[model samples]
Target: MRNHTSVTSFILLGLTDVPQLQILIFIFLLITYMLSVTRNLSIVILTLVDFHLKTAMYFFLQNFSYLEISFTSACIPRLLYSISTGDRTITYNACICQLFFTYVFGITEFFLLAAMSFVQYVAICKPLHYMTIMNFRVCKRPIFCCWMTTLLIMLPPHSLGLDLEYCASNAIDHFVCDANPMLKISCSDTWLIDQMIIISAVISFLITLLCVVLSYMYIIRKILKLPSAQQRTRAFSTCSSHIIVDSITYGRCIFVYIKPSAKDEMGINKGVTVLTTCISPMLNPFIYTLRNKQVKQAFNDLVKRFKLLSKN
Candidate 1:
């Protein structure tokens, strides 16, 4: 048992062992971080400034973009710093902070995506009562509720950390501070902590997954019944977007949280966490551009504004 002063820091093993290769990967991720920040910030600004984009879809999209920006910023900058300097160690408290916010945003995202799916379901399936029910307040309420719920869930992870004693290794296996990897170092029985995490995982997955499935089921049924070819095409178009977003978020998340018995498989799960944390932020802008018309117009308008401003 080594001297333990609160497991004050951690070491990260990122990318390649070769210095040259690590530098190259760092540059690539640096470019990605730039694009993620620029694209997501652009969406946030456009959603706020564009009068035509005041609809419920764009409103929620703005929130999504903002959250993605926060999530990526938290994860990527640290990873980039590690890559450049080869100093992957993060302070123990800092590691906990990272773990806390990562899950908070992640779980919030889980619920938010379901909420957005529900919004689309209402718009497509119950077109008659869409405006009446999905009023500004109703939509905004869930956004607040999901984040508030996320904060509450974050407390348990922090509490679990407080209970653990780090008598052995302090080096985290992966690039960032994650719950399961962090728990792997604990010199204490993790029965309570592991059980709490398991329960949280099951509850979040079942509730959010069910809501998305039901929403889309109704969405598909409504699309099939539409009389005109154009309406049916448009409805299918929208449904496809929701389905795509759902697949990306839920798939990576399910893989990350759902425990496997093998250590090798667990390593694989940790590796793919980069997908959830780093890659997903990049996709949000593309999702909006590909699926939502208002975002396209907003992007075009923003480009024109910048060009005109440059001429001045």
Candidate 2:
């Protein structure tokens, strides 16, 4: 076991080793990051200020916006710094902390989305009980539970990371540290830790998948029983967003981390990992919130309120 005090830093093996492409990536990522911040922050503001958006749905969204902000903050700034300064190195302690938070948010978000889907399923499928079930207190608990549960379940991964001996090659294949990548750099035999991580991740992923699948199964059955076209349309509209976001997050995540590296397809796997961490967080705000009329209305009202205060 390597003493934590002895290990200093790590090197990132970013998207392309090519200097020319680094510039292009920086430009593209920075723009996407900026837009994501602006959009999510806007959602956060609207959720707080708009009385109409005080439902369970927007309550969950407020947490999502906050996570998306921190999620991007965790990696994008480091990527920008690495690109501009050619400083691909990070202190080993900082690298592990980053990886932990990234994993925390990813897992938490998976279950949060599942929780949100179930909430919608209940609201649409059991309209009589929607208000009783999804009150403010009831609503926030599920999202918060996801965060707490994710942390509890992934304790082993964190323990492994904390005690890791990283005396070997410090060069990480991605700009940000992740569980698989961080484990790859361990100087000690990481088979136990790797199996622990894979088992936990698979179990977490499967549980979330089951929650979403069952929620939608119930939702679909409910939707079919509805006689009104408008009711069915509304139900489809709510669930469709979940289907899109889940497909992106879980689809890419499964591709990236599920396969053991002894059977690795490095190129394809790496691309999927990047998409999950980098691309999906940016798009999630849009897919889940921006297209909704309620969100748009809240935002517009916020702008109008600001302008009225300015005139006063």
Candidate 3:
């Protein structure tokens, strides 16, 4: 790690400079951050405690929930703090740490989503063998691999970023310590690292998305082959939640990160990033739970248990 001797800390040019807008942004972020953490944590807790949700699908969901909580927490709280207080100066070490965790958790989610899609495919396309294929022991392997794969992909570029010399400007555009903005301000030759970052992102996106698409193709085909309309509907219904979540997860990321000149639209990108990190996490629990009967039933049972304990 090259010592960033000249620049001890970077000034994060948060969302806006206007005090009134800042107040509103702070309040909005505060509510969303709290709700995102709570709802995602609720999913994690429900999956752990609810017997009805003990399947492989819920296992992947529980991991996804944990990822949602972690990914949002990695960036949102820091932004909230920056908005609330006037403290936008993040230290060199702190900024690097933030960037690392943000990328790790965020990238890991793509792999996990692909894993979830595979679980869905097995459940739908190979119902007879679903349990044997996706049992608890078998399920843990993919989840472990997801994290390991993400780390392997992310570490090289992230480490290369640390050696970036910043003698000139430390005022990072937009909120978090994102790679693009940090790269914009760095005084080093960033071509190689930039390509590496883009390649890593593209590789992650394409590989995971291919898994999702192929899984869904088989799933759809299998669903169509069911003789009765009711059976097809039921099968599709089981996958509806995953499909919606996948669309949102992949769509937003593609819009924000896939482009060559991501730094060009820093302003628009920040807004999308807020939506990605804040609103999406808060909304996902609702998206997954509201459309599914099993999760709702599990939640109601959990609520009743809490109520009975309070009375006791």
Winner by TM-score: 3
lDDT of 2 by residue, 63-173 (tens): 888888888788788889999998888987788788888778777888887888888887887789988999988887787789889988788768866877766577787
Candidate 2: worst 10 consecutive residues by lDDT? 256-265
Clashing pairs in 1: 8-92
Give Cα distance to truth, residue 49, candidate 1, Å: 0.7
Scored by CA lDDT, what does every candidate get?
0.81, 0.80, 0.90
Name the lDDT of candidate 2: 0.80
Highest lDDT: which candidate? Answer: 3
Q: Once superposed on the true structure, which residue ranges of model 1 sit more than 4 Å away at CA? A: 1-5, 257-261
RMSD of 3: 2.5
Q: After superposition, how far is residue 231 of candidate 1 from its true place, in Å?
A: 1.2
| Alpha-carbon deviation at 32 in model 2, angstroms | 0.6
